[model samples]
Target: MKRLLVLSLSLLALCAAAALASAPASLLTPDLALERLQRGNERFVSGKMIHPNQDAFRRTTTAKEGQKPFATILGCADSRVPLEVVFDTGVGDLFVVRVAGNVTYFDQAGTIEYGAEHLGANLLVVLGHTRCGAVTAVVKGDHVEGNIPALVANIVPPVEKVKSENPGMDAAALTNKAIEANTWQSIEDLYKQSPIMREMVKAGKVKVVGAIYDVDSGKVNWLGEHPKQQELLALTGGAK
Candidate 1:
């Protein structure tokens, strides 16, 4: 047992070393990373995707040198919202953390922090999509079973807030508005849960942004940073 433990520790250390050594000295600033994603989505929308970085050479380089992704995406686990395809990003180009509703619960928050802090991804995007079943389920107050309730619980607050603020709105509009609201809520939750992310954003080490992906149109509508970002940052005295 002792020998096995030593072997495992040695392997882990070597992996971490490789990752650190492969990381670029300079990473893309948030604005540039965002622009790249926008351009890729435009190509996807135009049916002209160049599919950058998917070649065998690219694969071998990333596998040997570890990932150097420029952007970290928190997106829904919906089948229609395959983030890499939607953004036209290829291997080693994006660090993606996906969950239903794209909520920033504890595990997802920690994963995102790893992407930004350890992987050197300077851009963090909370991407919600149109016709999101997670948001729709919460808006309709669907009774989910098993572990699903736990997953949907993170979405409840934003869905309820949208409902309260837009009284008498039809179900379709409520769900639509809630989807966007949920994206912002995920950012708020990220800042609330992870001091690392909050400090990173405060120091301009990373930029947190939101967007809504239209599944039907294959276009990403950028919403930029949260409108109440300063207010959210104030939670940790990160507001300037």
Candidate 2:
């Protein structure tokens, strides 16, 4: 019993030292961080991911030291779309904030800013997905009449705007458009509504971007450039 306890303590101490030594020297730059995520997604799409951190040792090491996630992803609450798996990231690679419609309310925005400002994360991604139930609910004109309504309410304006723009579009097309619009709107909200995020953006400390994940292809289509504020407002109609 004494020998087993001594060996366990010794192993734990060695693991702690190894984890510290393996910590990244500095936070990845925004562009580099984006590239890493893209590469990981590509691996995911190809079904060729190495899945480096699945070992018990890796999990134990991660628990011992704090995470140093490179990117913060505000993704949907949809079960089909998980940020870590889509990005091929291990336990500590992403700081994720999930909600229906991927909307950025005050609390969500504050959480994202906290990750960037304090966690040394350099990239913020608003990730939406195809066939998102939240977007579909808004497009189908479904309402919950209570607190759930508040959640659906955030998604309605964009769905309505897209409906107005493309009168002849089918339900599938409308849902896709609304999904993209919602993602872009969330990105805009983060930039304009949060002072901390704005300062981080202006100083190049963090980059806020939007992407839509394809459920079928497992690919992420990153919105290359941010749209103008007027264009975004027109799409969302300044939905509160």
Candidate 3:
């Protein structure tokens, strides 16, 4: 029994070492990483997905060396919004953090900073989708039980803002508007709340952008245009 246990331990150690030896090297720049995802999404919608980098070899390499995902996605925990399938990315391509409504408070901000600083991810995406249950629950003011109320409460501000801004708008439009606002609000909160993320964006080491996924169409609608290197540098006051 003792000999068998020793052999098992030795094999486990060897596997760990081999995995470490095959880890990925370097990462794409923020803009390029975003473009790669964009292309992947386009391919997905167009029915031309190549399903790149999802093979067993890629999995083994990531498990061994560690992950160096180029883009970090802060997305909703909604089941239909599968980040990998939507972007058509494989293992170690994306560092994803999920929460209801995609809101960033203390813990979520810390998680984003981990992807940026620790994992060396250059792109951060706050991805929200249409018909999200969390946001809808807030809009409806449904009495949820347990800790869920606290989670849904974070979305109320945006919903209220939408109500105030568009008093006559119907419920559907209001929810949609609020969803966009909530997504951007989370992006801004990350800047205001986390010094690491703020500094990284200022230093041009990271780019944070907001996007919306249409569940009906399988399309990602970025709130603004894609990041231009010149514009980004100018916006950051030439921090890089």
Local distance difference test values of all predictions, in order = 0.85, 0.79, 0.80
Instruction: Please identify model 1 stretches exceeding 4 Å from their true place.
Output: 1-27, 237-240
Clashing pairs in 1: none
Cα RMSD to native, each candidate? 13.5, 9.7, 12.2
Q: Can you write out model 1's per-residue Cα lDDT over 96-116, one digit (the tens) per residue?
A: 998988998888988998999
- TM-score of every model? 0.87, 0.82, 0.82
Q: How well is each residue in 1-240 modelled by candidate 2, as lDDT tens digits? A: 999999999788656433432335254688878877887788789886656455787688779987778889999998988888887777777899999889988778889988998888888889999989888888887756667788766677777788899999989988999999888778877665576766667678888788999988999999954677434324422213
Q: What TM-score does prediction 3 earn?
A: 0.82
What order do candidates take by lDDT, descending? 1, 3, 2
Which candidate model has the greater TM-score, 1 or 3? 1
Off by over 4 Å in 3: 1-27, 225-240
C-alpha displacement of 25 in model 3, angstroms?
Answer: 7.2
lDDT of candidate 3 over 1-240, digit per residue (tens): 999999999788656433332334263567767777787788788886667677898889889989888889999999999999899787888899999999988889989889999989888989999998888888878889998887776688878888898988888988899998888777766665676776788788988888999999999998752334233333332112
